[model samples]
Target: MTGGSAGAAAGAPWAEFGRRLRSLRRAAGLTQLQLGLRVGYHHSAVSKLEAGLREPPVGLVRRLDAVLETDGELAAILAEPREVPRRTGRFPADP
Candidate 1:
């Protein structure tokens, strides 16, 4: 949240990233609490990340990429989400 990147951070890509996270989490049959436990975060934190209301810490994103077995896809989104092709099939539809 440093460098005035707070409010300015949530864009189309950010929202997409959230959807992607939710999709991945669901596909793995993981509740927010389950993923949070695996990632050293709280369930509320996961909720915020999926809601695009907060930016994920880089380390956390990396951990998520690993824990979710997304193969760096989550980190890739943060790195260049705009280039990520949206694929609802690849990700379960968010409820």
Candidate 2:
């Protein structure tokens, strides 16, 4: 889905990460499209991240941090512990 859950939007770590990303992007005077291009992602992907609709992959987070010159602030947000969804028995095990 392209939207964050209500709980996630309500002060989740990813949401905080998104907020920081937006702030840094603005401080750097870069548009979403520009940031995406610099980080090798589509602008929609950047929008989704800024909206807290997705958790960025680790590699992408590093790229974002570097591109935005956050000095590891962005990475630190993701490093904080969050709850993992436990798989149900009905679902196949992840590879």
Q: Which model scores highest in TM-score?
A: 2
User: lDDT for model 2, on a 0 to 1 scale?
Assistant: 0.85
Candidate 2 C-alpha lDDT tens digits along 32-82: 999999999999999878877788999999999898888888889998888
Q: How many steric clashes between backbone atoms does each model show? A: 0, 0
Clashing pairs for model 1 are none
State the weakest 10-residue window (summed lDDT) of model 1. Answer: 1-10
lDDT of 1 by residue, 35-85 (tens): 999999999999888877777899999999999998999888888725656
* Residue clash pairs of candidate 2: none
Task: List the RMSD of every prediction in angstroms.
Answer: 13.1, 6.8
